[model samples]
Target: MGEENNQTVVTEFIILGFPSLKKLYPLLFLLFLLIYVFTITGNIIIFTTVLTNYKLQIPMFYFLNHLSAMEIWYTSVIVPKMLSSFVSENKSISFSSCMVQLYLFSSLGASECYLLTAMAYDRYLAICQPLHYSSKMTNLTSHQLASGSWVGGFLSPVLPVVLISKLLFCGPNQVNYFYCDAQPLLKLACSSTQFTETAITTLATGLIFSSFLLTVLSYIFIISTILGIPSITGRNKAFSTCAAHLIVVMIYYGTITAMYMQPMSRFSLDINKVLSLLYTVVTPMLNPIIYSLRNNEMKHSLTKFFKQIDKRKN
Candidate 1:
């Protein structure tokens, strides 16, 4: 079936990202530019703060450093191209470039999902099993978790791309969004997409939804433990530790769920594009804010660092 379909299908696609809003191009460009700036600045601040503040040398912050790095690359993967699309009338992506974009985007996304899970587990140990928390999330163990998250994230996209490469693209090549996504690519394939679809869906759901479930479960135990704390201060301290993780988890998972957890027939392409923007574009921008605001260590480090810079300038 795939071979038969490939004979008649098209080879490449034109990306129609934000196409109908020619009048709003300038406004959209400014908005996205601001987002890109904030996202990069915020993540960079956290990265530098973590590296400079030796007081923050713990499993939680260790995982956080990796997460910040991922956000930088993740946002970089999509935002520049999106900004270009707003300015360029053509909005075209080559066949090979599209696949590379898809692979890198998927890798970063998967790594983020697992990184969140690792953070949750770190919190769980601290809250629910305080005695063994240090032993369980030792520097060595944390290193392994962080490394695993990155490796797993990169690996998830490999199988899908391999499968996609095998298929023929002989039809309409217009991708409706700013970046190359698996579903959009799958839609443009000239051959039967049963294998590609199943593989992509399985990997996406397994990496995203399963990781989400693990994070949620970790939080459940964490919240329960927090409530059991006898003092208000103790509970507040505990919640504060996990609050940043919770906020980021909600935004990332919520957007992803909205995009992928529905029936295909019921999924609206417009809504899909909008939801994709939330996770791909907006979430990375918000991550640093969420972590910085909720974390006192980060705040203190940032303030001290800025004060040093001010003094030097004087």
Candidate 2:
């Protein structure tokens, strides 16, 4: 009975989520709870603002509307479970649930990459190619670009998730990270994971590298245009249009590149934990703040939104 004697396939994984901070569960729970609240509330505000504000019915806000929606989904896929693990005695997730988390998390993340690239391209057209900007970025075209980003992102991680899901996990079902990431899952597989790892690397590189490259190229053209404007006020206005976007792009891509580009060994547990927190939790909250703080139009719309609520309350 060789088949009967083989190790039983693992069906659940104990997420050893930030075990070093075991003594600080309360503090960590409270911290993550606050992060979750802020992230959800902030993104909801941005989404609602774009939808209701008539003045914001433009290409830039169209992309931002999608980004806000993505941030909500992206963070929800990870943080809710992470928060549960912090408070629960049993931090185990079922095999099926873990795979679902993996797919949705990867899908939303990939979608954001393409969505950000689309936003950069929109800014590039509006600033650099101003003559054809209105024609090129029509409502129909914006709708198509947004649709493509979501569809493409949802499809990008399909092969990897399917292949990885088929792997038999024989032993050591304790995941070191808070969530089911590709590297951690690969580390737990009983069979060879070289092909899976290679595939993940290539796909990740294509999404991350290509998106960053396009955004950077767009910025280069953008900066060139801004410099050619001789008027001080015009230059300031042009740069201000992109300042929020550039800040968000830097923070998001910088953390992501550092986390995924390097070897597994490079991801020290503490550093990886911190980076994961930043990417999954902090960035979502920060993006809305950056957009509203740096954008006068967003601020005004937000003001109008709150005033409307106040009027209804009275």
Candidate 3:
């Protein structure tokens, strides 16, 4: 009751999005708008291409399709609001709105972590155990795995967001982030945030490290299997299959771990913002390009997709 009463002191938060870039709002708006359009368009293309193409119906591409879909939602949660902050004079988000945003963004992030781990496992099966891959990663199994990731992702952030909502925000309603991020929001709470901070850190660390460990283990077996193949061309072909996913894993895990594993005070607000952008804005944009450029089948499907559109126009 007291917490609720104290919360009434600050009803909304001012999202101080790059206050240092105040003069360049228009240019930043245009840049982020272009990136946002490209991200949505790119992921949609990947999702549609994987769905329509008969040849790309294997387990690996199946997971990629789910990944593209998730990325679309993940980026959508953050980027659009960020674009609004750039253009609109009113940079405020209501208390309820902020909590909702935090829940969605964190949920999608957790979902991506699980989804990436699942993708790694799929690649491991395909590369390390080709014979059993078909039987083990059946249509039903793939759907379950994909569905499980989404379920896990959404459920992971519920407790954290609930705890945050109960925190007493008595004053200083400014969030020094482009979005309603957990760390920045926690900073504004007037009540004792030690327990909440510890809970977040523990949950985040467990989730991130466990998923990262599984991915690394999968890659280890994958690499060992590839190295044992006698022919150079055969080994190269095997390596090529999982390379894009591995690169993405490294990039995704790298930025997120650096940002979340340590105390926020270790990095300046500007640094934190930049790190957040890498995972939130830049990674989604890079996903389709990485997959399309690295995989021949994806490239072929993309070409066919565009050609079909051209034919329709003619």
Expressed as tens digits, the lDDT of each residue in 135-226 for candidate 3 is 99999999999999999999999999999999888889999999998889888898888888888888988999999999999999999999
The count of backbone overlaps in candidate 3 is 0
1-314 in candidate 2: lDDT tens per residue? 47634978999998999888899999999998998999899999999999998899999998999999999999999999999988899899999999999999999988889999999999999999999999999999999999999999999999989989988798899999999988788889988887887888788888899999999999999999999999999999999888999999999999889877776555776687788888889999899999999988999999999999999999
Q: What is the Cα-based TM-score of model 3?
A: 0.97
Q: Can you give the lDDT of residue 72 in candidate 3?
A: 91
Clashing pairs in 3: none
Poorly placed runs, candidate 2 (over 4 Å): 1-5
Lowest lDDT block of 10, candidate 3:
1-10
TM-score, every prediction: 0.94, 0.97, 0.97
What would the per-residue lDDT of candidate 1 be over residues 1-314, giving only the tens digit for each residue? 65674465554568888778878999999999999999999888888888888899999999999999999999899999889988887777778887888889889988988999999999999989989988888999999999999999998889988888778877677887778886677777767888777777777777777899899999889988899999999999989999999999999999887765554335656778898999888988888888888988888888998898899999
Collision count for each candidate, in order: 7, 0, 0
Candidate 2 similarity to native, TM-score: 0.97
Model 1, residue 183: C-alpha shift (Å) = 1.8
Report the poorest 10 consecutive residues by lDDT, candidate 2.
Answer: 261-270
For model 1, the stretches where C-alpha displacement exceeds 4 angstroms are 1-12, 263-265
